[model samples]
Target: MVDADQTFVIVGGGLAGARAAETLRAEGFSGRVILIGDERDHPYERPPLSKGYLTGKAERESVFVHEPAWYARSDIELHLGQPVTAVDRSRKTVTLGDGTTIQYDKLLLATGAEPRRLEIPGTELAGVHHLRRLAHADRLQGVLAALGRDNGHLVIAGAGWIGLEVAAAARGYGAEVTVVEPAPTPLHQVVGPELGQVFTDLHARHGVRFHFGARLTGITGQDGMVLAARTDDGEEHPAHAVLAAVGAAPRTALAESAGLALVDREHGGGIAVDASLRTSDPDVYAAGDVAAALHPLFRTRLRVEHWANALNGGPAAARAMLGREVSYDRVPYFFSDQYDLGLEYSGWAPPGSYDQVVLRGDVARREFIAFWLKDRRVLAGMNANVWDVTDTVQALIRSGEPVDPEALADPGTPLDTVLPRA
Candidate 1:
């Protein structure tokens, strides 16, 4: 049981950290709670950074997870803009960038992740960018507004969710855009080739050019500003601005320094945690993108970078830290918005794990639900422009029962009917 007077220090002031603090209070832990973060701003949702916020559809205040006043009212201390340089597990302390040390009885590492920086030459140029924080989004928005409609060309270096969403936003602002991907298809690893084609076709219809199976060798610049990006095949794509959306790597430096065991690199390199979100060190725990927690459903330790994981994992970790019986076993879920299409995906199945994909609606109309099955068992499901079926899909995945493909693919059959009877 948690001692009533013990102090709980939470590292990383992202959604996970904020939620964990909230959970502590809700659980009646009146102990001192402190949240530290490197960013100057309070915790905020990141998905809108590429979509609504970048496109000017959402305001800056709307993205915040909580207002500054909320922390004060909740009795949680905020240590913004101070990076934690090291964690001294032996002393039960964390040293900040300014050399300030904070002691704690228990700690939560929710350091989240950082964008994988491009190491190619000319990355330091003025027009080259990476979208990870709100500042990056603000800079990109300024660039878009200055260019006017259809006047500027944007070259996106990766075709992942961030790249594609930025492409859609750029197109919305009337900027000519081209996406270059080293893979054969966009989002090939996540949605696979068949469904990936749907996105390629959608972007093509909106006049967004694509160069697949190409590697970016260097970015050519003029007056220290990006002018074009050249591929390994020696083809140069002209651009007013370039965005490298390759992917993000979990922030694990502090955890490593503190001697926390990380998952094998093949499992996506993160602080290894059990179902309760406790690290190998009993006094330390991890959550959000930094924790590779064992999933009861998948029967494997998986590190998910989606918003849902952070949202749910935070409270679960907090409860576990309080010595409460809790398990972070929610099915992984994420969503993306590009152009006019909104996509919701639930469950996890590595690429090539599922033998077949069964579709329930029209792909051409962009309204459908697709299910990936392995030996008739639903492994994952995605809905594009189709609403009110995610819970049903997640239920089917949780049940782990065999589902009939004919009924799964039939548009006439409701999704609820596909599940096993109570």
Candidate 2:
């Protein structure tokens, strides 16, 4: 028995909020639903922004999650290009940027995230770029094309996922890429040095230069346009364009003002929530990048900034809001595409969390599965150009069973064969 008079309001029009709204209708909730977004564009998946869309492989309309009429037909109250400036939790209301206030029976925050702006000098230059929004990607696509057509050099700051993907896209347009990172390898904080070198070599072989063990100190420019990227090592990499692919920070201003508990910066900061995605306020919930959720398997708070989290988390939060039994313990998953190599990674194994990494198949051939193990217990697994096996790998981690490294590394031994018997 659901309350037909209730009104549910979702802040943030990203994939998570859209999916949650869809789930509400699908789950037989006939109540009123209102969705607000700061950006005018409809909800869309972000993967293509860095992958296909940036490279001109995907069309502008392909990234959207729904056809335009779907929201109207579904009876969802849609508000676009309006930032929710304040939240009155005690009054059960939210104030938009233009001073419009709306009341809600239940509130969901999926405010998502924004790119971490570069604090270095010359960031205000015309040719410097950051790629977190649709508008940014659109502008960057033209920049890459012009650079490639002119045989210009592009310097990228940071070697994170965004950086590497943009580098690959830029290379496809025939532009020279120089990636500046402070770590010894690309994605050092993520896949760690062992797997980082794989990406390093991948881009290096494709004519992309690497300036590892260095940071972009500043940008040099003539007039209002960028000329080159200056590294902390006292070296300047010539460039017609500079892209700061540092990272993103979760948008949590509304949550903070509402007095919601938040995770610390060092712990991947976001609104702190329990297993059920319930924030400090019972009527207020959060999901996607903004929710620092308590993961049961990992026994730690995780704020995953991947598309899968938003894809799955939204529906889970919706179910919880409906008073249905829910324990969101899905295995963390994400994938990446760079040039000819495609990789799918499952589970968590940040650096220092795993003691050993075992490989199955040939690493040199770019076809293999890398397993991170802690005391023989598999913590995470990544398959590079190796298809399938995600279910098996995730199951092994969920089983919490220690496996023999020899059999885990054997290509002939099927991954599931090593799992504990039912």
Give per-residue lDDT, candidate 2, residue 145: 96
Backbone collision tally, model 2: 0
Relative to the unseen true structure, what is the C-alpha lDDT of residue 194 in candidate 1, on a scale of 0 to 100? 72
Model 1 segments more than 4 A misplaced: 1-4
Q: All candidates' TM-scores?
A: 0.98, 0.98
Per-residue lDDT tens digits for candidate 1, residues 1-422, read 33447899999988999999999999999888999999998998889899899999999899999988999998898999999999999999999999999999999999999999888888989999899888899899988765556498899999999999999998888888999999888998898987999999999999899999997888988899889899999899988899999999999999998999998777699999999999999989999999999898889999999999999999999999899987788999999999889999999877979999999899998999999999999999999999999999999999999999999999998889989887
- Tell how far residue 378 is off in model 1, in angstroms: 0.6
- Residues 325-399 of candidate 2: C-alpha lDDT, one tens digit per residue: 878998999999999999999999988999999999999989999999998999999999999799999999998
Error of 2 at 337 (Å): 0.4
lDDT of candidate 2? 0.93
Give candidates' CA RMSD values in order: 1.7, 1.4
